[model samples]
Target: MSLTHLDARGAAHMVDVADKPESRREASASGYIRMRPATLALLAEEGLPKGDVLATARIAGIQAAKRTHELIPLCHALALSKVSVDFELDSVTSCVRVTANCRLNGRTGVEMEALTAVSVACLTLYDMCKAVDKDMQIGDIHLDSKRGGVSGDYNRADTYTEQPTPIVAASAEAGRVPLALEGERTPSVRVKCLAELRERFGVSELSVPFHELASANVAGLKLALKNQYERFIDIDDQRLLCAVNQSMANDDTPLTHDDEVAFFPPVTGG
Candidate 1:
């Protein structure tokens, strides 16, 4: 049938795959990050001070795979039996290559889950060191290959295709330059934040049952983080970023403080 995530007019709606059969499916996806040589070196030496980058990234990748529905609208949730993420240092371009694989017995394809896992894991790495390198870009989050279910088997024809434009600067008002490097905080940051929030939190509208503040007053990404983490304790931006990075890194408990606000990772299945 047509995608339900799209609207009656063929807009965007979550596709209902309830009618599909349960079969063993697998998908492989890949992405990359072009980073500074210094950053690569630091990562190689464990100098980022955020613990093992690759290890945390692997966990984040798995978590992302599991939370694909939470990130993308109309995406079906599947019980992924196996998830694997690999990282390779590309010395030529000073980039980090990330590859993710997802497997499950389900009706729908797990392609989105595999790609999402790689994308989120890469973003987590960028966040962990964004303080040091704001220009560090996350690139190439895409489904490289897939197999099983009605869709059957498919793979990307181009091995080195350009990455998807996951992060786009928001359109600026007339007479004002679009948000770019070095300028008064522009709408782009807010736009990117909202985009990410929608992906990380299942809520399309930032409305939650327990949110203390209404969605409108979020002012900026503080809401995006809040959406993903549920509760935002009173904390500085750096610390909050760190806590989020750490939680993603270790797949540990949410950041809770006696007198401070915390960012909680989305609850996982037991």
Candidate 2:
């Protein structure tokens, strides 16, 4: 299908939704932030430096939903009727899941608003706990569902499933080389640089072989990039953001050959 944000001449422009009939629209989005067990314990006990982490994050999410149009250039401003942010703590995974919902009677969908809420909430959680847990990861931000839009409704469960796919073969075959060979001909990780990182690095995408890294982890990946290119020397672990397969990741997060990795600067305005 054609993208609504593009005109027939393939130039970027806002889609005119003024002619569309107004309807009550709602959207839900979710994400999570993972941290150390000790950090989680501190958070549970309200012992962290930041006071009331969840409460602050919830408010941040709600505010983000209301101002999403200001952050995203093409989004239409709407009079949102309701916005809510909820947090669920999971001890087993040492993570907190954030879910946000937005509703409004308008011509446009509130999907971006809901997504912005979740994203900002996760980021706020990270910011609050960073003093004690610099290795925290924010990830899995996605739209869970939407309703009342002209495109109908959508539920993530109805369209998506988590299935592990093999990313590399065990050994060589024909012209292909095995990742197990290590230094000989290791498989590569697909790396993407987003936002300002793309401009700083002068390239949006590149690949790094598994063998080039000092270790199979996020830190290793960053170090390898810095070693290969002098301009990457400015990459800072504490300030930079990272994701693996669209989920937030920390420096110690392990990696395998052929994994999709992204690095970007900390986001602002949700």
Candidate 3:
């Protein structure tokens, strides 16, 4: 038996907020829809065939917040003070993030209202663009924060907000990170950077530090790069190119003093 349902057979009783005094309440929720990169580019630069996607999604979210109680069996029909839905385009991830905020002065919190708003907003975007993009995936629905509740204020400490859009496009064979040999006995190495790495670390034909030559293993090099560009990189992305004198190498590759090495994002081509 579900606790949230009001069926007579259910074991739980309705939670009453009658004794509680009205307080200002606010809740925020977020979700995402991922699609092909080209489709995302179109959404950002040009309007869709079905009219403006942002306008429709925003209206749908507002309407969904008002009808939360009807959609959810146990939710209280909130007398919402305000409901705002916004979106941001993340080109690298090929995702559109939908954020919803619900505010009210009521006995019950409006978390459900906010969640419903985000959910429907994402759905509306998928529906309006389904004709052009069939591979759309909706995920990452989560409650970001809540306030004015018995449980106290809560916030998600970690949230991904895409920053510093990738500047360098796909690189051909000629691209390489800045490299220089300083010490007399040091081995010469060519370091190449591609895609996001190039822009994030700003390493383009630049001179290499004396201690940062071709001595460490591939794993160690990755660690060093991560430490140098931690803020701009996603640590989980360990898939980088390890080439020894133009041949593909792995983490086990022993970098010598005279090898050409490069780091690159996964190649994508149609």
Among the numbered candidates, top TM-score falls to 2
Question: Per-residue lDDT of 105-221 in model 3, one digit per residue for the tens?
Answer: 989888889999999999999998898999999998878999996777868754243221212213322443423323334333445554565665555332223256334666655
Tens digits of per-residue lDDT for model 1, 79-194: 88999989998878988899999998887888889889899889888877666677887886777888997756776785345332222233333463322333322222212222
Per-candidate local distance difference test: 0.59, 0.80, 0.69
Per-residue CA lDDT of candidate 2, range 100-200, in tens? Answer: 99999989999999999999999999999999999999999899999997799989998545342323322222463333333334467767777666677
- Candidates ranked by lDDT, best first? 2, 3, 1
Quote the lDDT for 97 in model 2. Answer: 92
Residue pairs in clash, model 3: 177-192, 178-205, 178-206, 187-257, 188-257
In candidate 3, position 188 carries an lDDT of 38
Residue 264 error for model 2, in Å?
24
For model 2, the local distance difference test gives 0.80
Q: Give the TM-score of candidate 3.
A: 0.55
Q: What would the TM-score be for candidate 2 when compared with the true structure?
A: 0.61
TM-score of each: 0.55, 0.61, 0.55
